[model samples]
Target: MAHHFTAYEVEELLPELKASLGLRRFIDEEGNEVQKVPLGPEPLMRMYITMVRARILDEWLLRLQRVGKVALHAPNVGQEAAAAGSAMALREEDWLFPSYRELAAYIARGMNEEEILDRAMANIDDPLRGSEFVVYGHRKYNIVPAPVPVGSQVPLAVGAAMAAKILGHSVVTMAIFGDGATSRADFHAGLNFAGVFRAPVVFVIQNNAWAISMPSRRQTAAKTFALKGVAYGVPGVRVDGNDVIAVYTTASEAVERARAGEGPTLLEAVTYRLGPHTTADDPDRYRPREEAKAMEKFDPIRRLGKYLKARGIISEKEEREIWSEWGERIERIVKRCYEKPPLPPSVVLENVYSEPTWNLEEQMRELEESLEVMKELGIGVE
Candidate 1:
């Protein structure tokens, strides 16, 4: 049976029908500051540098992947501002739950390029011990590693926020996910729980227009991803993800609200993915080449650079120097990491248990025996 909506129900249940709303933006595509936001020169410079560094690292990772040096990469070519801007808004004590494409967020939190390269290469220095590919989690930075399943981190972030609230800790948790993740059960579950308990969490959706081969249009029937929060009784915010200043301002507000013991805010960052989803993807098969080219005008790094240049914060000469020096440094790091040896196969079995189980010990012995046989036959285990 279908239920009909009355006039009051229509107005209350469907607010999108009342009036059209636009995404918040601080800068134009031409890099002109259109709206002023309360961000200083220093952090603006830092965000720009972090975006550039992420772009360079993305390029090198793709190159390394093409040559079979790196295993895989989830590039953040055009979505740098969404990650860097929001990440900069968080306090040091706050926790970050990241999606796979948050390279700028990792860099913003002080993860160095060398460690990033080491993880990409799955070398001996990789903190994950080569168990995962390009999934980053750092204890010092209070970042939780991304899981392969989409939207799974949402509940985790909500749980952590509730725990903090109960313990009377001043910590807030932010979870970053993509538009595609909204379709998952975890997303709905987390948002509902957060709304009821008023969890101190900020949910950021980087709506980059594509979820692998699926476009954003097909992802949902809602006018905007942010509005999804309204159903859960959480306030919704939409920002221009390409404009660094706008993203930072909006995220900072949301973070402060959550830290003040208010309910979570659902933030939708409208942006585009200018490259393939990952090195394994071929975006050309789904999206047009012209579309990606068209998005270059709204490039986060380009827009931020122009804004900084106009204010005399960064000169053209300094911009060139930053890119060139960072590019060279990344190349050097890649070369050194590529030369490093991979961990032995046996190492995987070492960390699974405090004391080796009998079955695991038997398997280890069998693996050793097989390695000895291969060595005797002049066959490399690798």
Candidate 2:
């Protein structure tokens, strides 16, 4: 009996290729051109600044959480490349659907430091109404407010992509999520819907090895996170997440593919979470400290730094100056956030609804009355 293989069967039987194709490189850690991804001087400098700023913001916010100034914080310390690289790939008019831990994405998309710090400080002038809500919008930059709920932004990204398609626009939407989100139903649903509708959305999963305490192995039995896209009939790409050029190149291709009306693509960036999941978590409890230390050898910022230095885009003196300047900027922002006053009692009711419902109106009245009573008692609202 002669058996003929179908196209799908043939694809399944084909040998897997290394994930280095379509990547740009300038230098390797050993100061050699070992299949590097190249970046020009200006863009290289910009990437360095953006990555530093993201790290600084994460550190400051974690401090705020420790001091009880902020209720919660999710650190994106080690996942900067995944956020910054994909964000830099977007066109100015393109939209971004960000998960909670996307400080880099927001900053890269032109979110002001004050706006971000305000939200963290929960001040009266905070753009997103002092964290009473999650979405922080910068209408001019086309960056959507980040959603706090896990995997919720996936459908929103799909919807935005569909809208862009219907309007005959070339805009692409990138939905950023963590590996933990892949197990959720929304992940599957969003991918399936996007694939079927041929939506112009790129699903980027930062596979940082753990979903809080749970390891990636327990997250799924699948050999690779990228393979999940195969079930939805979209191209799935797994890239070295710590390789800034590789991450940028992969995301750039996916963005272009979506814009050309080809369809959605799933990019799994395999990176590591160096710090604890949040200020509230203790990584030592679940993962080994040695493993985290081992991952530091592949730090994206260091790798890019080496690449840029090797290409003469940046020198050791310039790197020191940049670090000093970033330190000053971070200190200034942190101080500003700490000095700002808390939100007023009235602000809590402002953005509760587009138009206040009767129930909301009643609640607002009650809140105001309670404040008035507190004032009578000579007590000030914090």
Candidate 3:
């Protein structure tokens, strides 16, 4: 590479960078108009439906964790718009690599609540021997398994984008992670590689402000996570993660650019996580009372509903219906989850290979025979 610097590259070197693009909201939290709603009733309603489902499921999962129906969960209570809006921007052919808390995004990507419940339960019906964490993936959906190691999934998105480029496929990949991910090793390695190669990927940083107990101030010195991408030559955009319209517009632009053979873009969606980092942690210890109270008015669901109502897209009764419907659906699923058992031991052997190895087949046969003998002798399987 040449040592000579170009004006475009020098812009990144400036000491003082502008803070945020400001909160890109369509409606204030009080049901007042801020900007015109971006989509019609059908499209906007689709997002609303997804958000409600996500919220309902999120609440139930947390409840299940408390009751010991599930071992653990990462709740995405307040950040639904961040996931739905960004995910909705992608076409069916595009790929998604999401962090654990992006359940809303996974739901938006067409993952069924049943599958989500089964995964949470780690039951026999779950694919992958129930080893896959709550973070999910399906080849059909072009989603890869989220490795639970924080931001490690970023490079995979980069690699996939590069593969798409090499194969001349007009597909873009979106890597979604939380604010803390920006501080991790993979974040740097992946984004730097994507920038150099100009891979068709969008890095969606769900800046919900906390990585476990750490606040945003403790995460980085930079005013905005989006600016971190500027150093790698990736275009950076900071948006109101709470505003579905704002999130969709910026993510769509990035996707379009990627499909056009342009490089990656970094987006920082400013939002909040109203729940604990996961079911295992307690947020009250770290979160301030004032901050929590102040953020409620910006709840993504309420704000979006306000916009929808103002535009005559949906009414309160319809919203109530949506909630009631989800309530029943989730109730049915919870009941089913309770009746199911964990994955049978045999599935562990069978799932390892499309066809079990010779040794594995021999072992399985022996185990089944042993079980049968024990049952006949009045011995318990457990």
- The top-ranked prediction according to lDDT is 1
**lDDT, residue 329, model 2:** 84
Better by TM-score, candidate 2 or 1: 1
TM-scores for candidates 1 onward, in order: 0.93, 0.91, 0.89
What are the per-residue Cα lDDT tens digits for candidate 3 across 1-382? 7598889767765532342444566666666767775567777888888999999999898888888877789998899999999999999999999998887888888988887888787787665467765677777788787888889999999999999999999999999999898889999999999999999999999999889899987889987888888778787888889888788877888899999988898989999988889887887898886787788888888888877777787788887888999999988988897789878757656667777889998999998898899989999875
- Candidate with maximal TM-score: 1
233: Cα error in model 1, Å: 1.3
In Å, residue 5's CA in model 2 sits off its true spot by 6.0
Off by over 4 Å in 3: 1-21, 349-382
lDDT score for residue 114 of model 3: 85
- What would the per-residue lDDT of candidate 1 be over residues 1-382, giving only the tens digit for each residue? 8988788886774543221145889889888878875778898999999999999999888888889888888899899999999998999999999999999999988888988888888888887788888688788789998997889999999999999999999999999999999999999999999999999999999999999999998889999999889889888888899998888888898999999988798889999999899888999899999999999889999998988899898899999999999989888888888899988888768778889999899999999998989999999876
Candidate 1: TM-score? Answer: 0.93
For model 2 the local lDDT of residue 241 reads 76
lDDT (Cα, tens digit) per residue for candidate 2, span 1-382? 8988889887763422223122234344344556745556777677778888888778888878888887777777778888888888899999998877777778888887778888777786676666443345666778777667678889889999999999999999999999999999899899999989999999998999999999999888988888788778777888877776777878998999999999998888888888887777899998999999988887778878887787888899998888889889888978877898877767767776789999889998899899889989999776
lDDT score, candidate 3, position 382: 53
